[model samples]
Target chain A: MTDTTEAFRLVVVSAGVSDPSSTRMLADRLTSRVVAAAKERGRETTVTVVDLRELLPELPTALSSQLLGPRFQRAVDALSEADGVIAAAPVYKAGASGLFTSFFQVLDNDLLIGRPVALAATAGTARHALVVDEEMRSLFAYLRALPVPTSLFASTEDWADDALNGRLDRAAHELVLLMESGFARAVRNESWKRYQHTFGSDAGRELGIDTDTDLMRLAAGGSLVDSEDPFDPRTA
Target chain B: MQFGIMSVSDITRDPVSGYTPSEAERIDAIVKIAKHAEEVGLDVFAIGEHHNPPFFSSSPTTLLAHIAAITERLILTTSTTLITTNDPVRLAEEYAMLQHLSKGRMDLMLGRGNTAPVYPWFGQDIRQGLHLALENYNLLHRLWREDVVDWEGKFRTSLQGFTSTPRPLDDVPPFVWHGSIRTPEIAEQAAYYGNGYFANNIFWPKEHYRRLIDYYRKRFEHYGHGTGKQAIVGLGGQAFIAKSSQEAHAQFRPYFDEAPVYGNGPAMEDFEEMTPLSVGSPQEVIDKTLTFREAFGDYQRQLFLMDHAGLPLKTVLEQLDLLGEHVVPVLRKELEAKRDPEAPANPPSHADLVKAKYGDDEPRQPRPNANRGDNVTGGSPYQDSEAEVSAYPTL
Candidate 1:
């Protein structure tokens, strides 16, 4: 599939806190290869990295009062504009780190519907290898995001393995194809009204106001009585 | 440019003193606060209605009526009166009675009380809140404007020939303001009926409310209320003032840290930056408040959140002294000078309403034919009605 547009927007969300953290490395690997894969298909791409560490200070206020601080607002704007996404989180205990899960959780539902996301996770041991598929995939699924089938996992041992690079290539190729498929663009452009969106949700993008509804009819000083079942106060 | 105080009616503990005002004490103190607001030359005093604890103002009309009797010229109102849970018929009756009792010194701001449990307490579902708010206001709007309303809607039972009584002061219904933070439907509804739109510009960022306000203004003009710039608008913000910026911060910090709903969450500075909360000197408050006019445009009312978070009555009164003595007077002159001549200088009072309905003529005084047992009259209840025949043939 080929897009007539000049460049695809690819966003990477990384929950890795420290410099050169494995979680971030896994996301970067996907990011670089996705750019390469898009080039192979003759498509240019622009990448934006949303470091969860930079979002940490704003998360509390966002959760508490639904007020997006500058950082969260920027992240939401970036995520909403992405043509494809790469979400990479570190494993803490058995689940994704709270920072990673929280960043996704705070986003309004339907914000990412139909967008292709490539999932990746890193942990200290091989026991954490299943975190991407078993844990992180479900979260993306709940967000209505389409996760590429080749979920990337990197334990310390797997990082040096050639198989890890193979999964990255496959995922990157899959993401580029999904982006070219124009499914997410179609959903946003065509079928967006079919979804139930709260006013001001989706980073304030869902603003279509239909004045023909019953509620709107009533709001405009119209009577609530329908002709089919008109209420006759005199009869009652 | 009407200046006032709008409280959540919170009974929060003094984080610094470790004492919570009893409901009785807080309720008693609220009247004093409203009276003091008038004494300090503030123009209006509004309270909220809440069924849950930590909030004492369950019945706002009662409180406002009492304040109306004791004070003169200070407009009494609610930060919001729940239009969703309470029967709008009852709202029409009660606020109309308050309107008459206060001698046209009162008004209404309606909200869809979305506190989930409170909805069920009134036999309503929170999910249907917007529908209820819309349909109920559709009915409430008529209840005030029309002598009798025959209506049926999804949420409430059908009403036939129902006349909410006392019939409004001077045949003029109290003005209504539709309050919302984010809901476009609420804004649209306000525009649809040409009602005043009140944005509780306290928590969210200024741009957030700014966008909604602009939308409301555009829709208001679309609905033929007025030009976009002349549409009636009100703002509810939070502010704390002292003579010096340092004193203001030092006095308000503990209250901010432990305030209900947002305490222990974001730092005060961050909240102030994100929201329109002004905490500083009177000049600082005026400077911050002046920006609201720039952002929201020429508008009618500006109400502040000053009494919540359990600041003792003494401190609250003192804050009022500073606000009255130093703040609102200057705000009045500055905002007055900047106000567009075409935009309304104040929200419609009962006198303005009476005049609108009947200019230089006597207002309609409803003389009831008879009660007809439970207000179900065969024809129009008032002498002014010229139906000439009953919709139902009399027995």
Candidate 2:
């Protein structure tokens, strides 16, 4: 438990607006794989699930306002705060859904830097399945997130296929190994892990940081200046 | 040079342990799988949305946003963003927001999904899915490229001088790939606008996709996007590999034997006989995939489906290791060597285009008057002719 908590947090974030969707099914399979693999390694783990549907109606508006609003600061605080995330969506268009994507645009930049992610998608048939790899993987790469190699794709047929269950189990084991590798080889890397969030202290007024010098130092990853009252909103 | 991975969120029993992973577990799988995709040098990770039972991904953009938070250099796109079912206005705003978050590493595939039940769920008529796709995409295209839009259509409410924000990254909207397995109309749509065409080649034989790809390429040339060979293409594939062919087949056979699609009447072997799903050794998978170019021409993207058999996470990870260390490198090298210099290297990147369009400058000044007839450069029909405006009702 100590190692798992200290090692990295795992988050499975899915936006399945449907009651029974291939996207949700695939997400479940992958999660089981990761959990099982972790257990096999005797590594204790904690998992969190944030269903975008629960946030819906308000999701689009909240994501939009949080991204474009003056107070957009609160947007994506959780994403920026997490160590690992599993992002899933049902394929719409030739890409991700507009709602699913808006949540990302509002996030602070440092949030995704060098973090690990698993990508999953669902479609009606097996035909458009490649869109996951051809499009979503590239999106993550650009954001500097470390995505896993094996992506899961499901079609309507997968629902009844007992074989799909086997695939999900394999995927779970695979993910645990990959995450373990990520934790062991790269988790503690400063280049990869040091920066979790960034406050453009220079946007002091905008972000509410006070001292320009202190903001710059903070941005540079240096200690802040010693002040009589460091926590004061005004100044020390 | 395009790469990606997709998830179909299905809650099912684990083949080995008979344990059904919860919806939360499935969602978490995407995060880990996406990370592995990046680590192994894949290019994109996309999610699909469905509004029915057992399928969980109802909102792809939300999932994509989370993916954007954890990856770099992996282009995030969707397999099917049901252009027919979703509103253009909401879709516009969502993708625009993604463009900003991913620094333009986002793009999408538009399709009319197979499920008919989704139409009523989203207040759409299944019969009108194609029409709605064409109409909505037209509006979405303009919304991403145009600043202010004033229009009305059959399926959607009128937009009275609406502006979706935060304006696509650097004024360049995410590139689109119109994907279809059976619809020729989509191929024409993709070609008409010079966007990419994606044929998910999982079902049917190579000849089926060849026709679609050929049709798209021909129309693309007709539309003057470039030569027929320069038309963008992407393909879909499935795999279940182990060290040896026998071992891999032995392990995956049961899952395939029980696959909902492959189970019962057709049998797993029969289903594989009809589609590109490969349940064999890594070499066999690679070899089978290499034969794709013979049918689809020089495509830009290739994605594989590996995590579907309910094989548990351990087996899935081993497969990833094989793909990263053996399969992908081989594919990458072979694919690169086969490229034609004149062909588009990859999809048009928004970041590069943004930089090219707005170099060393703040975001382009909002061109309030730039599209006026006096300044129009014949780029749009609405520029000089108010008659073109009549096609759509005024907001």
Candidate 3:
């Protein structure tokens, strides 16, 4: 284990469309609170805010081509390399914004697996606040990201409500605790092989081609002729 | 290194002229393009295989046989012969017949083609694509190498005492190249068989293929084929060229912007920088191509995709002229200069394969024995076989 002096890198992905959207406001509040909480816990913190609006023009191209444009790649790289991620998306049609989902969709499927993610959502009415719990939580769960227990939802009225700050503080502290605990690094270091696809893994075995098979041996330039019995038993 | 061109056989309407060539015209133009490839001093001319509309290469051997009759020296090959859906026994027989027709002036690249729906059309499931590719190639490999094949696998029906006709020209099967864009398993497969690995290095970044090629090289050595540096590797590139860079970009932009595969995706400059696409002067093409050796190490073949995106045949021919006269000659020299002496100078040709197999002796000319009523009653079907003559001889 290393000392607590290392700076914890946090990335905030804000999927607000407008210049001063409340979704971004909620993101900024969450990021600052997380940073402050980390500092209180005697850990230094650095934050990168990825504004998804700037990536809109390239998203379709990225999705269609399965290749990321440079700008979008840089934003994705920042998130991928960060120690923790704060994802905040505005709710539209009772779900997280398409732009937000689209951004994550274009990422490599295994990229966010085992990373710590904090989910937040903003909607016009309190009725859609469950978008965080129902939509965002499931999204991160599918990605295999460990979402902190406390999810933040800010509605039109929640902005002025004092309880919003309390919820933000709780969620931010949980994320900071996850970061300081080094759960992400532990999972990445200890059991990463368990998560990856490799030559003899279950996926490779499922394909019916493993390393020791005759197909593999032949591929390795081994002769198929000189074996003790050339006929397959199944055929016999 | 062997420098050449490949076509996906897409029939798109010319974005600028708004005219689409008829199937007859496009097919004729493709043959003209192939002959022009040989005339321009290019060594290889490869055509793709597609079973659906918008692509016209369903019968590659038919088209290639015609191309073979017209040209003497051009090495004919498929940019990719579909291995997933096509029956391996048929692939073995058809390509063997092609080898005889071309007089061993041919080889093939195998790929599990990208289209999903084409699978069921051939009575196969798309979910088993990789398995089908693996099992089919395994059967195809044995079909060409062995005199008689008794095989069973998941996807295809059992083959008992099957002999793929024509028995490969001079008993040397056509050299194979496994072409893949993303699958490391394909590279592993290539390495395992000591066959060539071809990275269709278009539409993606060099870094993407670098990892794949690197894995192949390492596995090639791991399988004891050769040192990693000596692995036979081929790469696909895309280029449009002219005397001046401005003219090249100006002429190719309309086609590039409207191309069905990559159109409306990235800016021209960004795409060029990201992929192996060079859209400028012949000198720019030469310089960009030379960098591939540095990126992926000295490779065996460099094939460019030059005919798609509905560029007029006249312009495509001109592009070939520039490629043959300018870009390829310089690339050939520069790549050879940097190549390691121990590394393969070119991919194995018909002559090389024959020599490797026979070693100064006369190669086998297989004569089938008279067919018995039941194939199982036969000891062996060929005249050269040491098995007892239980079946009547052809004479």
After superposition, the stretches of candidate 1 with alpha carbons farther than 4 Å from their true spots are A1-5, A223-236, B374-377, B390-395
- Model 1 lDDT, residue B165, Cα: 91
What DockQ values do the models have?
A: 0.47, 0.01, 0.29
Between candidates 1 and 2, the one scoring higher on DockQ is 1
Write model 3 residue lDDT over B260-339, tens digit each, in one string.
89897777887887778998998899999888888999899999999999999999999899999988888888888888
Q: How far is candidate 1 from the true structure (C-alpha RMSD, Å)?
A: 3.1
Question: What tens digits encode model 1's per-residue C-alpha lDDT throughout A38-67?
Answer: 998888999999999998988888888777
Say which candidate scores most in TM-score: 1
User: Model-by-model lDDT, in order?
Assistant: 0.88, 0.68, 0.85
Best first by TM-score, ranked = 1, 3, 2
DockQ category of candidate 1: acceptable
Pairs with backbone N, CA or C atoms under 3 Å apart (clashes), candidate 1: none
What is the iRMSD of the candidate numbered 2?
Answer: 26.7
True contacts kept of 1: 0.63
lDDT digits (tens) for residues B29-80 of candidate 1? 9999999999999999999999999788899998898899999899999989
Best model number under DockQ: 1
Model 2 scores a TM of 0.57
Better by TM-score, candidate 2 or 1:
1
